[model samples]
Target: MERTLHLRLTCGLLASAARLTPVPFLDDFLGDRARRLMVDKTLSAHGRRFPSKQVAPLYADPHGCLYGCLLSAVKLLLFPVKKVLTWLFALRYLTRDLSDAVLLGRALDGWLEAGRLADATDPPARLQEASLLRSAFDNAVAGTDMQLLQGLLMKALRGVSGLPKAAWHAVRRLRRGGAGADPTEGLSQADDDAMKRGTAKLGAALETPEARAFLEAFDARLAENVRILEARHASG
Candidate 1:
């Protein structure tokens, strides 16, 4: 029964996706439609498998799925806008005449440390330097502390101890017509590359036993949540 329901939901989503036409800023319509169809079909299938008196839970599942799908889709659509805003703010901050390189350095250090904790890996010292450089670029965009910002950024590039040679190479490449000589331009390009690499790494890592176990646990929780909703509907 679950297999049949899953297949039906998948087909519904695909059909919705196929029906959408591509357009700038409106591409999410297709994904949104697909997500809605998936949720609706899943609930409908559940309703058919159970009697009308027992269909309340299935309806609740669809409701929850609909909200989750919409939130996810909206977030995905807004990600590009957020990146652009980040770049704009960073550029504005870099062209100023403020003097707080030391403070900026501390902030960058803390941010890098937090990133390391999140990733559970000891990234090279160069990563922290990269973080500071990136921060300086952001500060310039935000139009704050231009002199101090540049000083902090240069310090990050040169004085930051243990910076990876590869990072310096990448920075040099950016400076040498890799992209716009603008700091934001180089930062954006590097970010894109990093995202691509991170995604690839995550895909590979998900194949490990630990990742598989985590996925299994997550799936179990999802199923339990659905069942609980179903029970509430039944009781109502």
Candidate 2:
């Protein structure tokens, strides 16, 4: 998932949020697509299975993996702020293509997770920074956020209290229908199929010589970024 991220850097600074680690143990909140939505496929039905063979090539050829980017972006956004920033910094800084803009769409949920963006001393600048961050995120990933939103709505419905009998029945129906299969997602079969094709194609494309060269470059860039991060964050 990290390898195939559709990275776009909005600015040049110590940006971060999405982390590179295993998902926290989510309860049954995740459905059958648990594995897929676990990493960076919240709304995507593609199940974000980055088989070891397919990882390098997809990173090498970003063009062949827009769906992968979207999946990665969407999945990354669903996490808490720290993890999201980690993922963003990694993708935005490590990729060879610095000209391409990386969307911080995941940060739009800053309101949901206050302090995700560090607050300035002055209230005005703090508000302005948060607003800008949200607007940027809205521009990039709002379309995909709908699926995440729907899943959230389902969770909300399930969490609803003191609802009327009719409303409770409606919520029950929704759960029994599509929500039961994958509680954390609402992607249709078509969306799932598209992800399948995208994942397979990118995986296959990475096998080429061109992709191998790109992978070599990417590795160097990633190592360089890690060194920079260590230098900046390490204890004095």
Give the Cα error of residue 95 in candidate 1, in Å. Answer: 32
Clashes of 1: 23
Which tens-of-lDDT digit does each residue in 1-236 have in candidate 1?
Answer: 33332232222222222222233323333333333333333334333231222222211223345675767767667667754553455433221211122222223233333442123333443333333334343443344323433443334233323222223333333234321122213444554354234333334444456545544443344335435544664698
lDDT of 1 at 87: 48
Error of 2 at 181 (Å): 11
The residue-level lDDT of candidate 1 at 186 comes to 40
Candidates' C-alpha lDDT:
0.34, 0.31
Candidate 2 regions exceeding 4 Å error are 1-186
Which lDDT tens digits does candidate 2 get at residues 143-225?
23233222222232232232222222322332355422322134444533433443343344444565445444443443354
Clashes of 2: 19
- What overall lDDT, based on C-alpha atoms, would model 2 receive against the true structure? 0.31
